[model samples]
Target: MSIHSYQTALVTGASSGIGAACVRMLSRHDMRVTAMDRDSDRLAELASETGCEAIVMDIRQTEELYETFADRDIDVLVNNAGLAHGLAEGFLGTGNDQVDEMIGVNVTAAIHVLRAVLPSMITRKRGHIIAMGSIASLYPLGLPVYGASKGAIRSLSRHLRMELSGTKIRHTEICPGRTETGFFDTAFGDPQQRASFVSEIRLLDPADIADAIEYALRTPLHVNVSSIEITPVDQVPGGQILG
Candidate 1:
């Protein structure tokens, strides 16, 4: 697709991190983006920097998602909002609250958002949906909920593509390995753990993932890149814990 082929895009989690990166990259291509996130200030900052519209939204609230996108014509929908909480205490030790939160945000919320936007895309016969899954999706990790949530997204991406087979809509799943982000510190809840986990390899900059997103969106309308797995050159393909 040409840089200007897509006039507008809707990106969830478009405040900081990967979502913010995507907004910045897409704006450079001159696409009008509807950037939404829970962080109103950061979302505003992103919009100001990218010349895109910003809306403060929490995807966990399915009704709010519908209200936000009801009247919009979206050319691309990037489902990128998600979270991970370590279940180091064992399955029950992980606690039901954390599990519910992950499922609500990663799996349930994604379906609601997709359902709300897909009809318009189908009616218009033009759109692309990209989900930000993780390398953990390919194989289960010790963090059961985190891996399973992403696993759901990975499968959702494929099934969506199959369902939209003959339509102009396209679905792409991006599975990126560990990166230098607040995710490690926040998820693990230990600064020391963050260092231990990430010290093995250089991290991929958020801009790199953003570039991949832009590329997938910019691919010619006829050529749909269904899936992408990107990691640092030093990063292994699977099981980051392997010796």
Candidate 2:
């Protein structure tokens, strides 16, 4: 999808996965991109390849998030930095550290980004805010923390949309299920189990999710697509949870 003229897009988790894909696609559409991630090296690499600016900052730090976006004029804000499996197990197993980290990054960090970028957008009367959520939000499962986090995201997206009504600021949430990303391996304690859980499902590609982000941003100015859920056909599981 083609972006508006002279729009700047800020994508969190931009070093890789869905974030990176969004950055690349936005850049291709001639939108200036500020790619933010905790990994400096990977952020730089993505920047070089996509011709975007890279900001190395952990989302957990609110100050860093504000400082990173302080001087920039952003037209689109993609809150895409979050993980679930490890955090889920930790919450279930009573691991406080992991639980805190998960809440910090997935929920707290998103608020920080919104606070950092939203003021200018609302004042200027032009901007699009998108958050990456998951299907876990819709149906409750064993991963209480993760499901809760995504549920918060879903509410946040809808609330923001209503709050921004009668204004140019738009909000949308994209809920994707079972994407084929390194997250399953590197971010989880039992990569095999995680893989096995989704083995029979057709997973999404980073670009697929990215395309959804772009589409949400490119919708007609008068029309706001508040929520979009995307999942692979095989992962539908006959409208039931995978066994």
Candidate 3:
């Protein structure tokens, strides 16, 4: 898909997985891409491979984040940096630090980045904001905290779209089901546990979601795709409630 409409884009969590895929796809479309991630090495590699600018910094660092993109005239903002402790851990089991980290990165960080970039878009009166949500947010899930974070994203996207009504700016939420990424490593820690959890379920690749983002961005300025939920063909959410 051609992103000729957009001249520049900023993608968070761009070192790997869906974020990295977005960097590659946007670059292919000839958009000037700014890839951001905490991993300096991986960010450099991605920049080299895709010919995009790299910002090696944690999204949680609000001050630095603002400074990094101060002079950038971004046309698209992809909020994709997020993490979870594990499905087995309930809200209390996850502890304070992990909970803070999840909220900080998933919700707060996105807000900060938007705050920095939206002014430019509003001034230009044209831009697209793509947020990465999860199917877990759509239904009651075992991963309570993670689901809540994504749910916040859903609400944020909806409200932002409403606030930007009658303007050229657009907001879209891409909610994806199980995707193969390092998320499992951070959540489960042990390799065996991660394998066992995903062993039975069909996992979607990062590229799949990246393709969805491309489609959303490629749509005409008059067309706004509000939200899209994508899941692996073999995996479906169960509706039964266990007592």
Candidate 4:
């Protein structure tokens, strides 16, 4: 099956990595893609490359989101903007400022993005919301704050599907593990630190994630792939857990 009806899509954090890959993939499917990100240069480059409308702004500023989507009829909303900080320091050791930033972008901004875009979907009675979640949300590990933020997304995706029941709208969370993206650069600021962590397991590509999202979007309307938990084969969960 294919999504032949959706004419437009809005992807957050769309300047690079998985976001950019999603934009490219959606464009291939003949959608007028809107790429939103804080990186003006990269956004402009992407717009030039794919003819997508690029909106440059900090998603954390919730107020601007209201103005940005005021009149746009977005058929698909890729709620993909997020970041991780202070991996070097555990929760208590991590600075409160870093903690707040994580929550601001990953949680607060994600909600506002949905709030800003979902109205149009509700009015039209059709839409698809794709959330970018992480393995951290499902498993326990070194990132407590980061994991907490993603866990909130996990809950949000479920509740959103519940809320949209009986409608044509669909909500799916893509939980990816060890993907090679700018995420590693932000999470493990130090090159060596990121290398050290990924040394044990092979990493998945950003395109791999975009492929999972494509699968979710292309499914028949009657079928809602609520959540997709994808990870590298070598990178299994901790002992005694099949998840």
Highest lDDT among the candidates is held by which one? 4
Candidate 3 per-residue lDDT, tens place, 73-175, comes to 9998998898988555677778789889999999999899999999888888988999999987887768888989999999998888888987789889999
Whichever of 2 and 3 has more lDDT, that candidate is 3
- Per-prediction TM-score to the true structure, in the order listed: 0.93, 0.93, 0.95, 0.95
Give per-model CA RMSD.
Answer: 2.0, 2.0, 1.9, 1.9
lDDT of 1 by residue, 161-187 (tens): 889988889888999877676667657
**Residue ranges of candidate 2 with Cα displaced over 4 Å:** 87-91, 237-239
Alpha-carbon runs more than 4 Å astray in model 1: 1-4, 87-90, 237-243
What residue pairs clash in candidate 4, if any at all?
none
Residues forming the 10-long window of minimal summed lDDT in candidate 4? 234-243
Clashes of each: 3, 0, 0, 0
Question: Scored by Cα lDDT, where does model 1 land?
Answer: 0.82
> In candidate 2, where is summed lDDT lowest over 10 consecutive residues?
85-94
lDDT of 2 by residue, 74-128 (tens): 8888899987656325555746776777688889999889889988887788888
The candidate with the higher TM-score, 1 or 3, is: 3
Which prediction has more favorable lDDT, 2 or 4?
4
